[model samples]
Target: MKNKSGGHRRSKSARNEAAAGNKNGRRRRNKSARHGATADDGDRLSKLPNDLLLNILERVDTLDAIRTCILSKQMLNLPTMLSQFFLSAGSIPGHHDKACLFSCSEVFRTNNAVARVTDNILCTRNPKIAITKLKIRFILMPHDSLTIAKSVARAMATQKVGAAEFEIRTEKDYEDCSPADLLQFAKQLNNFVGACWDTFAGLTRLWLCNMRFGELDIPNILSTCKLLESLHLTNCDSGTDSVLQVKHAQLVELQVDYGEFDRIELTCLPKLQRVIYNYWCTYEDPLYFGFVPQLSKLNLTKTGIRSEKILELSQLLANVPSLSDLHLDFESEKIWVIPECPKLLTPVLSKLQHVNLENLPEGCDLAWTMFFLEAAPFLKELCITVWDHWCIMATDPEFRKKYGFCQKADVNWKPHVPDFKHKNLVKLTINGFQPDDGFMEYIRNILEHAVNITEISLYDRKVCGSCGELAPEIKDKVCPSRYPQTDEERKQITEGLGLASRAMVHFRS
Candidate 1:
């Protein structure tokens, strides 16, 4: 009996030893599976061609591209092979956390990261590989000046960057910060400009925004970039009172938006094909365009036209003999109320094909429209967007009270009757179409005059949700439709006017 019991105990111990071995084997298999999975991922990434990897990196922001360098050995050099680099504080990962109330510590950390990343990129990048484009946008801080300057200098030093953009924005509005503080930031930009002029020999496109010019002559600054093709200056301020002048031989496209200058003169832009000028603030002087024979497209947005110099616009149009597409937006209604003046010899735009006019004030006669239709005899398309500030005021009670409803007046002034007939006009689009007396007269004039008109598209004026009360109501108010035009109304408009039988009128909601 004792022998049998001892044998049973040995059998139990053997079973226990078998179970322990099985558990150890399972652990070994699991660990191997985990390691194998990681290796497979790494191998897949490493097997990709260098060019393919570089293409992938270029699509992301520079900060994200840099982060991939730590992911695997294959991606370590991918950032260096990129042809374009875009570095902005807004692009930094996790930097937008509570952005509006960003703290000082967060700023310090972001600044350090920016400096480190930029320095590493400039220093580690292969000299043979050329960076074709570089853009940097950041809020200028006191400690950020030197680092940004160095980065810009390093980029320009390559002598191969074809397009570059640099923008310095403030954390707060200009009104919130003192002028001295802003000037201090502006001083740092001078270093970047120096680097640009010294090394930007291959640059073709350059855009600078929100930077202080500080008595620096813009014309002289642009002269250094001999190869620049497109230039855009937005909200750039200069402390000097001198009229800003731009003259570039190689420039093809130029856009100036909301500058602090009193006047801007464009002279000797021989190759310029397109020019966009947008100014809303009050200025006594007029914009001057000179010797741009190749200019084909000109867009003027929110430009102020003084009551006295209305004739100057006609003279300015004489300079661009080749202008085909013209867009004009007057700043105020005062332009429409000019007094009786002697007939001026307005230049004819024989090549003008398309004309777009925006913010056509109420109660204004169609004299301006007549001016263009007479000048552009070959106009193929005309689009007019009517000005209705009442739509905006309907949203805010305070604004509505401050700026009362636009007072309607009788159309008393008669413009020069044009003997010219428009034969080439095919399409006309009028947005914000109200069936007021002025609009009716405008449409009648077009239908009677444009002999070859093919189609007229009329769109109801847009209004905010708050302005529902002020919107025009149909006579049959039971349906409660906004901008309802009945079949009877269309019949009346088309019957009297000698509209072409082939011409179709469309009313868009």
Candidate 2:
């Protein structure tokens, strides 16, 4: 009887100890949860591998990366080890917009910020780690520029910099500057580039704005950049109405925005893969494609037409057979691309996989877009966004008339391949969706033709760029979306479209 009593006492003691341990574990887990992570997770984050920590820091600005990891000493060391650095001329405190560059003192301060940031980073970096990429954008000032160029030159000499980029800007915006200002800006920029030939030669990318260079000036600049891969020209050209010819051996991407050129002829760019041109109307034919075998993506955005010609895609992309992505933004104006016969378009769009048509006018017939489905047999996805952007749009009647902006008209079209069946179209997304006859009919027609379609996304019209600063008078300009909200309405539409799975149709609330 004494032995049994002793065994019972030992068992009771063991139970009490287990209950105490459970209470302690719950307390620790609850405490960790309050900090938005478990204790184990916090330790793991602090002890992450060096490569992973560097990858996280490299995505943000150099200053932002430092602030995020302010608590971790190990993390603080990782910023110096990042392979790529993108530094911009810091903006003014109250004047974050580029329009504020008109202030001379503020512009000088911005230039100083660029020099200050570049000096701090390049001068005190970890020399053992090779910098693979470095991009710096700053205003054009002789004094500050000299300081920046010296720092970059020293860093390049000491480190194995794989690529460098520079974005040069002036004090005033392109529209705000006079002809004399533009000419002077061009001279300053030209001198800057000339002085930094060694620095620019190693540049993989370059961006310069508000420069009116001579006919041979741009070509001479290109010659100095022997290893340049990407060139961005903004509001720049040789003459008021001159033909700009580009021939670069190593150039892979070209972007021309608001350039004052009658026509741009890409004579020979062997490695060019992407091209983006915006707000160009100086000539009937905005561009002439020449010897760009590897070109796969092209983006063209135009607000209103000042040219005398309607663009034909078949002819524009006649040589680009490897094109996989094409984006066209009409700025809610007249549609520029001509829907030609399938035979004429199929060769140009043969390997095209993705197509995005943005800012189509609301009243236009969606049937005109069917031309792509019939032409590009390999197209995998098609997205369309229809909206009239108000903020940037010209609303004054007199200004609209001067630019020849016409009334919103429908583009008449009839499918050349009336019974054509698409086998590769996998998804369709429409942003400006409405549950009306026109929309429903178009969707039903698509369902019938796209036999392998899996997902159809419908979303309300999204205000791009800025939605916060809306004028009271134009607040009602946004058209209310009529997308079905109730589950029953959605079900009816789903059944009406004959989709087998409700999961395949998505309605973004």
Best by lDDT: 2
All models: lDDT?
Answer: 0.64, 0.82
lDDT of 2 by residue, 1-509 (tens): 24655753446655776677777757877887897685455555558898888887788776567566777766766766778887776553222374544456765775687787688778888999899888887888798887888788888889999889888887777768788887898888789878887887778898888888878888888999989999999888876788899999999999999877988999999999999999885647788898999999999998755444778899999988699999999988878888888889999999999999998888677888888898999999999987777776777779888888877777777877677899999999888888877777888888878889888998878766664466866767667667789999899888877776798889986
Candidate maximizing TM-score: 2
In the order shown, the candidates' Cα RMSDs to the true structure are 11.2, 8.9
* lDDT per residue (tens digit) for residues 211-267 in model 1: 556664466667777878888776665743446778888999988776666666788
**Model 2 CA deviation exceeding 4 Å by range:** 1-59, 63-82, 92-107, 306-308, 464-477
lDDT of 2 at 233: 90
TM for every model, in the order presented, reads: 0.69, 0.84
C-alpha positional error of residue 433 in candidate 1 after TM-score superposition, expressed in Å:
1.8
